[model samples]
Target chain A: MPTHNRIDATKVGDVTVVTFTDKKILDEAGIQELGAELFSLIERDNRRSIVLNFDNVDFLSSAALGKLITLDRKVKQAQGRLKMCRIKPEILEVFQVTKLNKVFDIRDEQDEAIAAF
Target chain B: MTEQSDADVWRRVIDLPSERGSNREVTDDLLTQLKVFGWPPSDVFAVHLAVEEAIVNAIVHGNKLDPAKRVHVECEVSADRVLVSITDEGPGFDPARVPDCTAEERLEAPGGRGVMLMKSFMTRIEYNAKGNSVVLEKRRT
Candidate 1:
């Protein structure tokens, strides 16, 4: 598959940070890769805290939102936490509409998100 | 292929041939134009999200990321609504088989919510299998 969507993951203390630089996250194949990467990162690090930084993303589809929710569930099962930050207001509204804001701890800035962990 | 004043409400239909690297800029331009029209932030976001999902699906799945195949997108704006249609080159799939996004087990799977989001935000969604197209309508309300 084409690597049109890029994702980078790193560890911040006990927290795992995944940054997506893709212009958009759509399609079945890309979403599968995203879910796999996130799950592996969590399982490998056993981190209770995870931060998804969408500072560079301008759009996110419901499929991508589903992945976030799924990852959140995984984190909880592992006794960890999931947080999201730097979401654009446009993208943030999607979360609000879907009521995902209640599921994930959202912060306004990356620093605040990391601090929340 | 026509130019109008920046302030004019613009509308057109373009063939989204599967020439892919990234069509993000094109999608961005459309959203920007809609934003300029004073589309409420939520509605704007919904339209952008829906368009991106539809276009990306066309580029990736429908056209198999083939630069040779084409996807067609049409946009129309009246005083109260925005209507867009996206058509792809692939054989197409059955919309009936799409699992419900709200289902508990399928909640975390990436990439199954395009139809769901379109249905949720758009006032009307019509799938034309004969044309391999999906039409979306969003009202100003």
Candidate 2:
């Protein structure tokens, strides 16, 4: 149901790496599509481990952050793990400022995130 | 110091319909203008994030995503600072009363984080008496 060019998903072993291709994830439709697609992966498809790579996203809205929080909660409830990697420094500054860096598992590289599992 | 006229500064004023995709378009346009003005990437990132949060709050929280309402954005970019004001036509609420999102109990609550993020990224923030309008300012650092 998440029909959009905003996100690209790939499987690296047992991990689903969802890289956001959009420079800005501000539109409600794209944000919703992302949330839906990730939700389906964990809840329906039963993908236990996920890594959201933000290497390409230069901008994101609070709505999108809120959606990520929801997805993280869903993953935890399902006993799955969710990690984020390759977040731009500007974006990572947001997580640090909000203290969300403590809430989620974030890494500096995709390989690091994958190895954590 | 001599006062500079409005023409001396880059300004963008938009009265947008409370539509879903309006925030993205406005943000893109604002960032482009800021970039053209030669703002540092770090400063641009901060201002961009703050503006996005402010617009989303105005459209979603203040106006409740009602198409009948309108959101007004005024952006003024200068060599030393960027000032952006967002006003929504809706029943305003007190920003002071917003619960702290950084608190342990409220971290997971989807609300208040936008306000927190806006306050965090912008160097100076102020709300109007009615609380329907917010101004975010960031001095080049």
What lDDT score goes with residue B66 in model 2?
95
The TM-score that candidate 2 achieves is: 0.91
Which digits, one per residue and each the tens of the lDDT, describe model 1 over residues B1-141? 332433445676566668653555556666777777778877877787777777777777788888778888777665467778888988887777888755666545554777777777778888886536888888876
Clashing pairs in 2: none
Deviating ranges (above 4 Å) for candidate 1: A1-46, A53-58, A66-79, A85-93, A96-117, B1-8, B129-131
- Residues A10-54 of candidate 1 have per-residue lDDT tens digits of 777767677896766765567778887787766765667788899
Query: Lowest lDDT 10-mer window, candidate 1 chain A?
Result: A1-10
Which docking class does model 2 fall in?
Answer: medium
Per-model TM-score of chain A alone? 0.89, 0.93
Name the top lDDT candidate.
Answer: 2
TM-score per candidate, chains pooled: 0.70, 0.91
| TM-score of chain A taken by itself, candidate 2 | 0.93
